[model samples]
Target: MEGYLDIIIRCVSVYFFMLIALRIFGKQELSQLNTADVILILLISNSVQNAMVGTDSSLVGGLIAAFILFLINYIIKKWLMKSTFFGSLIEQKPEILIRNGRSDFKMLSKLGINSDELSEAMREHGVEHIKDVKLAMMEIDGNISIVTTDQNQFKETHYKRKHNHKNLQGEN
Candidate 1:
């Protein structure tokens, strides 16, 4: 019983740590999973597994860890819904990438967005020029939402990543 209690504590601690880390680091990179991003996710999961379950490789240990994670997630969602202040702390506000057809160069640079990547997102939504964009925002979930004066608002989440592999097409 004591051992199980320890596992619970560890799982809960890790959950909160992850939430804070994501809040500080940003999450727009989540939807845009390139090869490297996929690899990083895999590695992180593996690394955290031990921290959650410790040396207990038993089935019950695994189930307990998973259950705690799910419970924490559910409770957090409910809490966030009831408290705007809590949600605001955990989630970042949407970042303005462009306004009035002028790109926010500082925000773009701060968010690690290059003009090419921004342009790619814009073109997908039928925006041919930055001057045509009424507003472009990087949403919390890592999707770029573009608004044009004449067109309906739309959002896309394609991450532009360059890879050098024989089987993959080269970057344009």
Candidate 2:
């Protein structure tokens, strides 16, 4: 029982460390993983395994750690739904990238979004020209949602981005 308690504490620490690291580094879409990113994740898991298990490499120890991780994740998800403050701390807010057919250059620069990517996203939404976009926003989930007009018909399209945008500072 004492060994299991140690395992639980270690796993809980690793889980929260990972959560904070991901939030700080800007969470990217899992589908957009590159070779290096995949390797990094694998290496990270390997390195953290020993830390969580310490000297106890028994099957029971591993299971206890896994259970602790799952339990903590479940609690966090429930809290996120019920608590706005908790959700805000863990999630990035959506930002307007383009408004009234004009690109917010400061917002773009801060987000490290280049013009070509913006253009591509716009085209994906069927907006041939940037000037025609009524609104474009970077959603919290690392997706670009473009709103456009075609022959008086409002159209909105959303697609996942490979990279997450950094928060823009001062004058959004």
Candidate 3:
């Protein structure tokens, strides 16, 4: 029981460290990670294992860390919902990567994003060329939000097609 308490304390400390680190690191979207960001996360997790578990191969430390992580995440989420400045601090602001089928070279360069990377993001979304993209934004969470000129019409047509199919099914 005494040993368990010590493990809990260690785990809590590690949990706080992770929370503060994440807070300081700000927000990153799933699409925008460079090589350095991925490596740092892996290394941070490795280092925390020693600090949280010490020499003991026990589950107590792991459980404590998990609980604290969940709690901190909940709190931060609530805070984000209430405050725009806090949201910006944690989630970052979205950047316009393309407008009117033209790339914003200045923003792209500032973010260390090259043309190839931007093209790849567009490719993932089934865009064959930049000309088809009317507006492309690098969202705060690092996701790419693309707006094609024909998307609205495409959505309307798709909705009508679905409605017609549902009516046919009903008649059957």
Candidate 4:
């Protein structure tokens, strides 16, 4: 019973520490990682492990840590709803990287995304080329949103071409 109680205390302590650390780190959306950001993230887990589980080095310590981590996460999420600053911290700002088929190379460099990677992301979203894109934004959650420049025009042109073809075929 004593060991169990000790484990619970250690877990709760670690949980609060992690919560505070995360809050202090500010809301860095996963997608906006620079080289330094990636390194800090990799180190964070190992650094916090000892605090989360007591020196006992047992599975029980690990389980308690996990439980505390979950509870803290839940609490933080609830708190975010009540605080606008927390919401903004947790959510990142959307960055416009492309507008009117032009790539904002400056923004791309700042975000550490190369032209090739951007091209690939665009391709995954069914954009064959940059010129076809009207707006491309890097969302706070690390997602890329691409809006085609002339969707309505493209659709209208396609229908016209198809109708003309059908008419020609009928005449033949």
Tens digit of per-residue lDDT, candidate 2, span 83-134: 9999999877788899978999998887778887787777667788887888
Q: Write candidate 1's Cα lDDT for 1-172 as tens digits.
A: 8878878999999999989988887865555467786898899889999999888889999999999999999999999889999999988888999999998899988887788778777776777888888889978777677788765445443433232211221122
Any residue pairs clashing in model 4, and if so which?
A: none
Residue ranges of candidate 1 with Cα displaced over 4 Å: 151-172
On residues 70-148, what C-alpha lDDT tens digit does candidate 4 reach at each position?
A: 8777887898789888877654567899999999999877766677667766665667889988988876555566788
Residue pairs of candidate 1 with colliding backbone atoms: 28-142
Off by over 4 Å in 3: 1-29, 32-40, 53-58, 126-129, 151-172
RMSD of each: 4.4, 5.7, 10.3, 12.5
**lDDT digits (tens) for residues 15-93 of candidate 3:** 7676567656543424334556678779988988878767777576567656766776788789989998887666667
Stretch of 10 with least lDDT, candidate 3: 156-165
lDDT score of residue 83 within candidate 3:
93
Q: Give Cα distance to truth, residue 141, candidate 4, Å.
A: 2.3
Quote model 4's TM-score.
0.61
Candidates 2 and 4: which is better by TM-score?
2
